[model samples]
Target: MKLNYSVYLVTDREMAGECNLADIVVAAVSGGVSCVQIREKNLPTRQFVEEARGLVEHLRPLGIPLIVNDRVDVALACDADGVHLGQNDMHIKDARSLLGGQKIIGISAESLADARRAELEGADYIGISPVFATATKTDIAKPLGLGGVRIIRDNVQLPLVGIGGISAANAADVIQHGADGVAVVSAIIAAESPEASARELLQQVTSAKRIV
Candidate 1:
């Protein structure tokens, strides 16, 4: 599968407000989100599995990849396109051994060394996170400003997706700094119009990729 990391949406139920996750995902995809990561940190294993399965069913036909955040078991159970592992999550080698070569594996990197190690461990992509401080995730690391992003981009070969406090306003700068994509949480999901937010973000990402 050719991964287009252009506009990645990382789901947060609380941030989604009144809209159902499925509905939010469909709307985001319709507005041009290239990938969706189901990130339910508070849910129990059973509920997480169910959510992953439902998202997979919804995204599969649309040709969008469903990535289970920090849950290899959920990803395997749902037959999801991939899994996104945080720094403290399962080891990449173990994940690779379990998911095999076909499934996508992404790692969260907070520094250049983390990014380099992820690439060496065979991650399909690296999420360079906390580009700015974010309220959506409480356990965020130090914010990686655009300069940090450029430094990591210069050091890693894997596709870079900038996360944390990302919105349409800063999406272009993120990409211009060498992120192949931007992973947003609250910006789209919490917006009154998820689809329009996604569209605007996608437009910014597309325009940035072209110029950079």
Candidate 2:
């Protein structure tokens, strides 16, 4: 998948305040978000499928991909572009058999071992989680820090996306440390202006990539 991972947005409806999820996504994509992942942890299966289907309609027109988080079934139901899997989620081999080779499959790696295994298992990309401590997800591992990103980059050839506690302020640093992009949650979703926030984040990642 020749994806431009810069300025990745992971959704959190709870943090969106009064903004509608699709509305926030439209505004963010208009600003510069390259990718959007629908991550509904508590929503029922039917609602999750409905939400993914809705976002796919919004994103497809803009040429942006909508990734369904940790739910291959939901992705299949919605005809989403891809699915993001946690380290403990379904085996990549099994996921591939079901989704086929056309769909993108991203694996979250909390450790070097996890990253290596994902690559060996044929994951399309690697999501480096908790690059810094984050309140967004209560059950994440310890922060990997910038050094951890460099370590994973050194070992893996796939694209790297740094998630957890990422914002415009540190997005450039994350890219400099070797991430192809930053997967942000509250930084964009909770902002007063999701468009402006996404614009700033894309700018940061773009500039850093130029330097790297």
Candidate 3:
């Protein structure tokens, strides 16, 4: 599957506020989110699987890929398009052994070394995190800034998605620095109108790419 990492949406049930997750996803996708990741860390395995399955049912028809974050079992159970792995979540080799070559596998990388290692380990893409310090995730590494993005971009060959505190205002700068895309959580999910937020973000990314 050819992935368009532009405007990647990582779901946060709590951060989603009053809007339902499915509704938020649909709105975001409608507004041009290229990828969707289910990242509920507190849910039970069975519940998570069910949620993934439900999302798959909705997203599959739209031709958008659904990635289950940090749960190989959930991905397998739902036959999701992929599984995104955090540095501590699962070994890339182990994940590949289970998912095989067809499934998309994304790894989070906070440093140039981690980015290079992820590419060597066969990750389909590397999610470069904490581009700016973010309140969304507590375990994030120190902010990488645009210079860090440039360093990682120079070192890695895979597609780069900048995460952490990325918003419409700063998204273009992230892409300008070398990210192929931007992975967002609260920027879209927490907005009063998720669709409008996503559309604005997509515009920013595409516009930046043109300039680059």
Highest-lDDT candidate = 3
| Candidate 1 lDDT, 95-140, residue by residue in tens | 9899989999999999999999999999999999889999987787
Candidate 1 vs candidate 3: the TM-score winner is 3
User: What lDDT does each candidate get?
Assistant: 0.93, 0.94, 0.95
Candidate 2 ranges with C-alpha deviation above 4 Å: none
Candidate 3: TM-score? 0.99
Q: What is the TM-score of each candidate against the true structure?
A: 0.98, 0.98, 0.99
Global Cα lDDT for candidate 2:
0.94
Candidate 1 residue pairs that clash: none
Error of 2 at 4 (Å): 1.1
C-alpha RMSD of each candidate structure in angstroms: 0.8, 0.7, 0.7
